[model samples]
Target chain A: MGRRILFITTDQQRFDALGCNGGTVARTPVIDSLARDGINYTRAHPQNVVCMPSRSTMVTGQHVATHGVWMNGVALPEDAPSIALTLRQAGYRTALVGKAHFEPLLDPFLRFAENRMGRDGTHSEMFTMPDGSVVPHRGFDHMEFAGHGAAGNLHYVGWLRSEHPEVMGKFVPNLDGDLEVTTEPGGDTMAPQVRTTNDVPRGWYHTEWVADRTIAWLDSMGQDDDWFCWMSFPDPHHPWDPPQSELHRVDWRDLDLPAGYIADHEEREKVLASKPAHWMGWYDGSFVSNYEAPLKWVPATLQPDQVREINAMVHVKNELIDEAVGRVLASLRARGWDDDVDIVFTTDHGEMQGDFGLLFKGPYHVDSLMRLPLIWRPAKSAGIAPATVTAPVGHVSLAATFASIAGLPRPDYTEAPALPVNDDDARERGFERVLTEWDSVLFGKEVGVRTIFRDNWTCSAMLPGTLHDGTEGELYDHANDPLQRVNRWDDPSVRSLRDDMLADMWDHLPSVVSPRRTCDAPV
Target chain B: MAYIRRDIHIARTPAEVWGFLGEPARLHEWFPISGCRVEGTKRWIDLPTGITFEEDIHLVDNHQRRFVYSIVNNMLIKDHFGILDVVDDGHGHSIVTYSTQCTPNVLALVTAGAAGQGLAKAKRILEGGN
Candidate 1:
């Protein structure tokens, strides 16, 4: 039989959230061990920083512009190319058990199949689109959907309501009475969307529920069957409400501020001022660029104590996710599949997590939102030595890698090649730069941002939009300013380098889909 | 009525910036409109989303570098007024201001966002990038 694949993904997690990635706050021994045993990618990024777009890139192995899921609230086309579908076509059992955000989660009329499946409890049934193509529900033979909170038509919400009705009140209500993401703030610091206490027991929380469902799905497969399973965790995203029982993992009062956060207000504003105009505009509440962040929440109003509390909650969530991963790996070991599974662990994108006093992510193209923690542990039986790759790679390379693991020919629809094993392999394979793009027209305010990460430099060019003209941009030398505290876009010293990078980026960008997709929902 | 007024400073002469804003036919050069047509004091503009607006030009004074227009037709708008001004800041720079007022209140936000983008694009073009 061919090697098995276990792809684990987390939502809105930082690159430094695990111990192997210099994260001292959360103990992620399970994921850290995976990095130690296999390849640890130091400079991996996503094609888009938001959930729907980045997740679309992961499944399709295509750039954001090509997939046309350029922002949240835009549903990926039903028949878009998918690696999961490719694996199933190769005679492998495939199942995606948690948090499949390939479709927008804000569907109210059940127009999208993902929400329809959740609403009708038909996750196991293969769905046929209006085009009469009967596919395995986005290429998965079985699927289960879970999101951040007790809102939407996610299967977790239905399961929670049906199986354990008592704990339904524990989670912070994600949607308000108007059926929008709730901006309610109730905690020690009154941070927006921050609920301090969630009384749901650890075992019944969505994190554990995801792992349990994945195990049950795995147990259903035959002993000799080759399979691909995606165990996606919806934690560490937002409304930081891990079960109250696990809050003791980290104390808010005892943690240090993130290295990216400038403690002094003026210093933070000065740093923000160096970048695009929207940075300070978002902080001071002068402009609302996107709907992903809480509208009523201003970054300038974020208190230091609130940053501590939020980080503590995120660390707690990370800890829970690690334990859940441990549980699933244990289940694999029990089935004697641990040694044969090519495991890939990563997140859709990184969170701001109090970086520069900002709490959520938007069009910001710095490392806080762009860099991802990616680790690929090849099957032990394959005997690939462990190494750290410092080259740039992106979500666009994931599908080809999956196809490689299955011993199948790379699909013609895939864009990038399989990921490199080490730095030398990356250099030999021409994996030199990674590109990320952002385009949003929320609240009638349009913003377009493009970034290129190459060598030790990061350059972002802002298109003509509400906040910035085409002339404004940011340039940060990662080797000197790892925290991206300064911008040298206009500096005469690096003008040549910045111009070259921007030229390369625009030349490399794929032609965007015309008559661009519309935003059906806010999220 | 809801109101919004935004200004941006460009390191260019007022006449230089007004060279692009003085003519009604060049509305799409900086604004988000895809195409526009002018017939004397009446004008029609098309947005990229295929929505068209019929406007009445109230004033166009090149000496003052000021232009004003109001949308006269559209069920979605109750009252819409827009003004663009480019004034010499007396230090070899020009300060361009764009203001909008609309009755639906939410529509003013839409116009305000477009005005912000339009003003930024004008600055970029006058200061030298395409």
Candidate 2:
């Protein structure tokens, strides 16, 4: 029998958002404890910065190019090889208990049906078998779809209707829409806006609901049956809305301004000018014409106080998630499965958290949005000692790592290596460099960016445009400037190093373009 | 509350337009569902995602060239009803109108997009003789 695998992911969490990871303001003791007991990969980076592609890579062990979910609107193919399917084949009962952004919430087919049907029932039946068991979509035997908003959240919305109808009434109209309510606009293009606070009660919050449902699922599992569960939480992501009860967990007065950020416009302009033109345009509101206007949350201006308040709300959301994780962990222990379960804790992608004068993520591949916290805690009997690894690993390796941990044969389609769990010299095992890609498909921009993180240098270049425009690239010497305030792509001294990194990135590109598929395809 | 209305000019008589739109089986052809199963006035629409939804027919008036239906027992919507009307344009052409009323105003955009697409498909098939 294999150990039960508990794969937990939070949305839009930063690498340094945990207290154990040196987050000064975040109160994440539960997640911090996971790092204390597990192997923490300090330099883990996601293959893509957005939600869909990054999550797709985590499950399929394929890059964005191979998976073809270059942006959020695209869906991961149901036939794609997944870790959940591989584990199910190994006799493990697989279940996903939270947000699976594999499919677009507003897909034309789903929207049309919902409009015609007048009711959005638990769409889980779509993924169910004739015997009433779930027909695994990408390998998970059961799915509890609690998406970000009530508009498309099947499970969470059902719970809300049954439990807290009043709260549902207030949130449903604006469900899944932009969470940020502009209370006070930034006077200029560099200031942040003061946003509204979250109003849901602590008990009815999605974070608590996800945890409660996950614990219930675990309790239902047989004593001898091994299970694989992905407990995904949708919070600490956006809307920056933390429940009123959880808001006091972190005080806004105690918060500090983001590192690598100063209020000086000239200094910020100098930093933004050194990178891609679209980034600066996003910051200054010039790029709104090029992309979907409503989806753009990046404000042209932000005040220091607004940024601090947003950070405070983010910390509160993090603490709430930590509390939820603690409950799930307690449930596992109560079932006497603590010693027989392997736990993997990570996020879909990193949040800027006001880093580098930026609040949300965009075309830029800065470390704040690219780097993620990767922690693995093997069962006590696995004989893997706890230690922090500094090697550069990509989220693309997670599917392979899950297979290796479950004692299954490696899937043939994956290009990622199994995570180095027991190896003391994991960094020396050729896990030195990671390639990150950004296809401007979502924003409808003409530029595509690819970045390589090797050694202490991060090199990024815009495809097609970088060849003609000298300024369309960025090179950061992270060793000297950890905050990445300086761009050295044009620096005469590191030209050779940049070229080598670019060649490595080109070498890792997919040889053939993989076609995208709908999630409803027959297996 | 959200309201969505889509009107298309089809090169067919009002009776011909209502004949195709009123029949549940013909409705499935122009609607986005891959297939549908009908039990009296209730239809179980099968989507590409494999999920099926139940739509109850509230009224079907052939003389008025109007059909009315409502989606019942749905979680995401409240007081949701749809109406499809066909009127003669006096030029041997018919003007087809599809309208919906639902709560949670954001769904209006979704309903509008889907209705526009469905109507466009119906116009193409009717005019192109497909």
Candidate 3:
């Protein structure tokens, strides 16, 4: 057995959210330090933007097709091999400490854990109550996690009432339906009893429990070991709110709302403008007009004040996670394994924290969710790559990279390893041409493709006008507009460029996999 | 000692599904466990008042979904399964189902409701074709 491996992933962590990448410093020293010593791939993107699918991509280097974890209620492809199997085969102890949303396909390798039920989520929290009632929040061996689909705002349950009386009536699951989230009474809630405000001194939040458990595991390891461990965070995902203390830090007066604050009268004619407004009661997220909506979590533009509060909340969250990262690293060093172990740090996806005047993350592939960060600390012998990979890449590389490090062989079923991870000059291998694609959404999700360039020439193709809802064809020349504020789809000069991108997207389809063969694009 | 057993070829392998089920955070992704929240060390207070409950995963039979854990918080139900039995049936697939009787919580009336929901989610998760 070689040195132990520590893999930690943050929930909804954006690529630009890190200090090394000019992500707001609010406070990410530990993560930044990890980047300083490791080879940071500036252009790593997720194979699947959502939790379940993205996690599948992380375990299997191949896209959704090969690994078979395409939808929420789907199982992993029977033939597909996961990273854990390979590691165990190689004689290393493999343990996943937190958030492993490889659902529908139930994480089969969980048997390796001496312990189970680390993180908490909606489905995991569902349980059979004492009185023999169907209670939400099932999976965790411990109790903590609530909600269904996107309805459980982590606050109050729709049907299940909390034992603590003081928090009663503080949360209403049925209150928010603007976006069709599944609300249930049987779930975990964060109301007056457990306010999500960034206020509590740092260690009291739920994230603290996660980190404490995972770090303790690392602390318990001995030098005679080679192990693979994963720690996943659930925050910065939803229920965005100003930490009571951090609230108003960025007042509406100080913030610049996205172009799509709320749909204009005319825009309302196209999509249901009030849909997002109604959902505000259930979630805490904000996005801009140009913000892309995801099929899973629908995005909504927020009130100017709501936007400021959400932004402050986002910052405070980063601070919290940053501290958690610092603590983990301190403990790693204390164990005398810091310099020896390989550390992988990154997130599931990015949160649209009011950037596009929208709150929370949607199913669409906006730069917010699709373009997440991938930071890796190379082994002592392997050199680190410094510049950002301007090329396009997919999230599938997580498994490929880890497998390569452990010298594990690739499984026979995955879509294909999209990119190769390198200790040195790896950024050069980032992406020749990256393509972004979406699976079947609720009835109708824009099933299109996006191609990004090192030079920032971006093209997206879906249903016509998807640029707003699920439209078709968006072209952006980022050199002139770094924020991608303008879409030049109609630009005459880019006629040939548009054709080229379309061809690239169509060609890349074969490489990405989709679980729902029914919704899969015809070859 | 009665158990209902069947085998199906889930799109992903046992290892993959195990990865999904291994973490408590992933329950909401499938099986409709509904809402959840973790408190204290291992005590999980489910909502809608089924009575407080606590459970712990004591060991794993790696070859099988056969995990041994005790349901204690509620005390009313002594539902426990030691072997998950996640093995290939040799018919181009594998079988993973537990055969444990629910001890029933305070609401003995709804015990079956909870059990049915859990098993249904497991079936959908294990057999869903992504």
Candidate 4:
């Protein structure tokens, strides 16, 4: 019988963000336990750095480019064979509960909820609700909206904040009001619940409650039969709202500013002129100098206040999510599935809350948005334990790994092959020689986005056409300057490394669609 | 130094309020938008060191708990003034106050709604007596 796989995914989580991965404040006891018991792959990449593309890659094991879903307008093709389909075909009953952004709001996925029209149309970018909450595009199966005030946009993936209070499953009034705030958007992102009474949830909260339902589902399933489940959380994303005690854990004054918190006025102007997209909001399309952007959006120059609020939100949400994970694991053990399943923890993308003086996830290939949290554990008794695969691995490989874990074969139609899940020694043995290539961020099939990563070497391509060998590329030895705060694009010493890497880039670019690349390769 | 304050409240103790007028140096405490600061002269506050912001004393009312001040680099703030008064109705006392009279700049005009949160938050914090 195939081993059951329990995949736990969180929203906007960065890879090296846990205590196990050197994070100073992040509390991920459950994840840490999994790492101690099993493998802790240090190098894992998301298919894309944005929610839509990254998730599409995760669901189908296809690159963002191949998945064909970009920002809001793009949609995943219906015919695309998903991981669920493959696992279902292999007799592994699969259930996806929570933020799988790629799941269609219509048809099969849409059938899971009552408010299908509002949910599907919003995600597809075709939903037309005049004068509704302008933030359309909430990417979840079951959505209980809280804060959106009728502009008809699913701008945020939050719960009806008013109801979230109840969904939280706990409350402490003596707590600071901010601590009580749930990222679920109790009222609207901007306005809060006047009477904490509205903070209650009526069964539509997608965060904690989602885990509750997910746990319940696992219990009802047959123990002897194998099952595959993907549980995703919507936070630590934004409005940085979480139940009080959780939100209060991190004071607003405690948030560490992101390196790229705010861009220079010139750069800010350039991005604003382009009117870059945001998670639940956006900058005015006009050119805006760094000074003009709101303090909340610019982490670099966050007003002393925004820094506090943002940190409070992120810190608390992380704790809440950690708690949720604990609940899932405890339930799994109780249901007798703990010893027979593999739990994969991950996230869709990372949020640049206020990095680069920018408000949302921008089109940058930097590690901030690229590196995503990923951890996997096999049941202790299963004896299928493998060492942490440290070689740089992509999200696409996960599909094949899932298939391989379930004793199924790699799908014949894929651009990339399945990465080996051999024992730790084997992974270590192959690290140096493994195929390591970071795909360029595709701004669609038209533009060439940069790709950088490797021990200390970084590469940037102008895209569409270029080679590091004078065609047009930038290289930096990040060993000395980790921030990549400096650019040695013009530095002369590392020309040879650039030459070799550039050649590798040219060879790496597939002439046409491989039918293999998923969402431009993630963290 | 032009920001928008969508609503207006005028209080009597403008001068006394200035004594405790919110400052920019420790901004994260009162404002909902400001939360944490890691590095800077106006760094994030904690139990050891609290959040504070320096306000350019714009206006003051001593009799009432009210004052107007601006952060150092103010663009999104036009003029913010608060009006407050504590009243005694024989048996007990009550407080009435108006909050956040700053005008938002052009950029603030769009996402300024987050500031409305500031007004409501300010009122509760100041008058809640705790």
Best by DockQ: 2
For model 3, the superposed segments whose C-alpha errors exceed 4 Å read: A73-79, A104-201, A241-301, A381-388, A409-430, A443-455, A463-471, A511-523, B1-130
- Candidate 1 lDDT over A437-503, as tens digits, reads 9998765578899999998899999999987778999999999999999899989989999999999
TM-score for each predicted model, relative to the true structure: 0.80, 0.77, 0.62, 0.59
Binned by DockQ into CAPRI classes (incorrect, acceptable, medium, high), candidate 2 is incorrect
> Taking chain A by itself, what TM-score does each prediction score?
0.98, 0.89, 0.71, 0.71
Between candidates 1 and 3, the lDDT winner: 1
lDDT of 2: 0.73
Q: Which candidate comes out best when scored by lDDT?
A: 1
lDDT of each: 0.87, 0.73, 0.49, 0.49
What are the per-residue Cα lDDT tens digits for candidate 2 across A249-276? 7777677787856568778888887776
- Tell me the docking grade of candidate 4: incorrect
lDDT by residue (A84-126, candidate 3, tens digit) is 5566556666656545545421111221111123212222333
DockQ scores of the candidates: 0.02, 0.12, 0.03, 0.01
In model 1, the clashing pairs are: none
Give me candidate 1's interface root-mean-square deviation: 10.3
lDDT (tens digit, per residue) of candidate 4 on A257-319: 655554365565454333212211234332222111222322333343454355455665676
lDDT score of residue A370 within candidate 2: 85
